[model samples]
Target: MTRFQSKVALVTGGRSGIGRAIAKRLREEGARVITAQRGQDTEFECIGVDFNEPEAADDAIATVMQLAGRLDVLVNNAGMMQEQLAEEMSLVDWTRNLTVNLTTPFALIKASLPHLRQTQGRIVNIGSTEGLGSNPKHAAYCASKAGLHGLTRAIAIDHSHEGIRCNAVAPGWIDTDLNIDFIESMPDPKAFKQGLGKIHPVGRTGTPEEVANLVAWLASEESGFVTGQVWTVDGGRMAKLSLPG
Candidate 1:
């Protein structure tokens, strides 16, 4: 319920999809939430901080402290995904992908560590099932997410002694607007959508709200014993073996 009555959370890219769901859920549970994104958002207390500039993370945290007075939860949800084959991907493209997905989160976490130490806060990183397995044309994306998972564990091991907890949520095929639109753009839209669901044992894709639930729990005090773990919330897709069609 009001476990976060006096707590403050910073959720990057909280303007849409999974990020929006996370921010909303945390706010619903009584946390004063600030969202950071590349563009301005009127719904939440938003700060425009592009992950492209990792230095922006420091400024963002300073802004959060000025606005909220303290930080209790840091949600590194902002990221990018570009599907380019390894051989075709330019060095610039490869670097940008890693910068947004991995480097920025690292920067943000580093900037927040001192404040988090003061409050004994938690960090929830938004990773992907790609971190656990490979996807076509996702060389950089997969590598970035895998690195993020590793970063999560390292942070937990290094900071748990300081009363900080770190964890990551690896989601697969969440029903976000971007995903729905891509599915709808297919020649056989209905068939394409069905294909997406069939990959999972649950017979459907996941929802942003489903992911938010896990993230909220991880960031809560109730998960005090939980740290250095990557929780997969992928509708059993990661566990089921696909049969030959």
Candidate 2:
């Protein structure tokens, strides 16, 4: 599917997990892929960046423009999840979550606007199902992702005339190393893992590639009319009513 042939894409945090999957999908669809991640070793053209820094977003965009010559798709995929209750969540953690999950994507979009405008490119933000609803002890994460979805809509509205489309994908309980690490860190990893599938109506958690495929479609011209939307790929989890155990 050479839908992205002759295109260039920059994916944030493309070294592993969901971001990595998205990058691979874009590449397989024929886009030249550039990745901004913390590590130096990567198969894709890499930019070493720490999203915690305020300048990281702009710096990444600049690097991509210099190396790749142009940007056709921007995937704001790097994010942090701080699982803390509102009562126990520190100011530092709250601010960090917003910075990484919300502010960084905004900065990247702003920096890449000119180039994307030239190419009529697209932006796919990796939001979470938690943004649409809530979970126990995920106050900071939910708030930040909610802000990210808002940012997605604003960009879509503001840039549609410029030929840039912005949309977000909200994933639920994706089976990734990061998610596995989170589950393993739990007090009862086995029970948590065992029970995770039943929550989704599909009877299984989503895979990174599943989310990646949706992102690829959204990034392509096939979804040209889809913008300012938050698409949830949650294995039917969002459709089910929450019932007491």
Candidate 3:
């Protein structure tokens, strides 16, 4: 699907995990992809910037414009999670969560808007199902992601008239390296894994590629009519009611 042929995309944190998958998918669909990540990226041109210093997003956009000349797609994929209850979580940690997940994307979108206006480009934000529901020790994460979804809609409504569409993908339980590591750290990894799969209607957890596929569609002209929405790719987990054990 050469939907993105001749297009250029910038994916934040594209060096690994879900971001890596999104970049790979865009490249496969014929988009010239650049990544902004903390470490050097050998697979594609990378703009090294830590989201903690969100001012870097502006520089990243500048670097992309200088090198790629035009940006057609902006995938705000880099995010962080600090597992602490709201009571125990310090103000600093909570602020960091908002900074990395919500504020940085806002900065990236703001930086890319002018270029996206030129190309009538698209923005795909990586949100989480937790934005729609609660999770233990995820007070900050849920709030940040919910804010991101709101930002996504606000951008779509304000800028779609300018030919740039904005949308968000709220994914659940994707088996990225970080998740795998978490699962492995469990005392009974196999048992925990089995229970994790059972929570989803698909009888298994999701993969980064699956999330990337939806992102690809949203980022392309194929979904020209779809914007200001949060699409959940959760294998039906949210739709099902859990029975108490």
lDDT of 3 by residue, 1-245 (tens): 89999999999989999999999999999999999988899999899888888478889999999998999999999999988889999999999999999999999999999999999999999999999998899999999999999999999999999999999999999999999999999999999999998899999999999999999999988899999999999999999999998
Q: What is model 2's C-alpha RMSD?
A: 1.5
Candidate 1, residues 120-169, lDDT tens digits: the string is 99999999999999889999999999999999999999999999999999
TM-score for predicted model 3 compared with the true structure: 0.98
Off by over 4 Å in 2: 182-191
lDDT of 2 by residue, 138-205 (tens): 89889889999999999999999889999999999898997889899999998887788888888888
Root-mean-square deviation (CA) per prediction: 0.8, 1.5, 0.9
State TM-scores per candidate. Answer: 0.98, 0.95, 0.98
Order candidates by TM-score, high to low. Answer: 1, 3, 2
Give candidate 3 regions above 4 Å deviation. Answer: none
Ranking 2 against 3 by lDDT, winner? 3
Residue 203's lDDT in candidate 3: 95
| Steric clash pairs (candidate 1) | none
- Each model's lDDT comes to 0.95, 0.92, 0.95
**For every model in order, what is the number of clashing pairs?**
0, 0, 0
lDDT of 3 at 179: 95
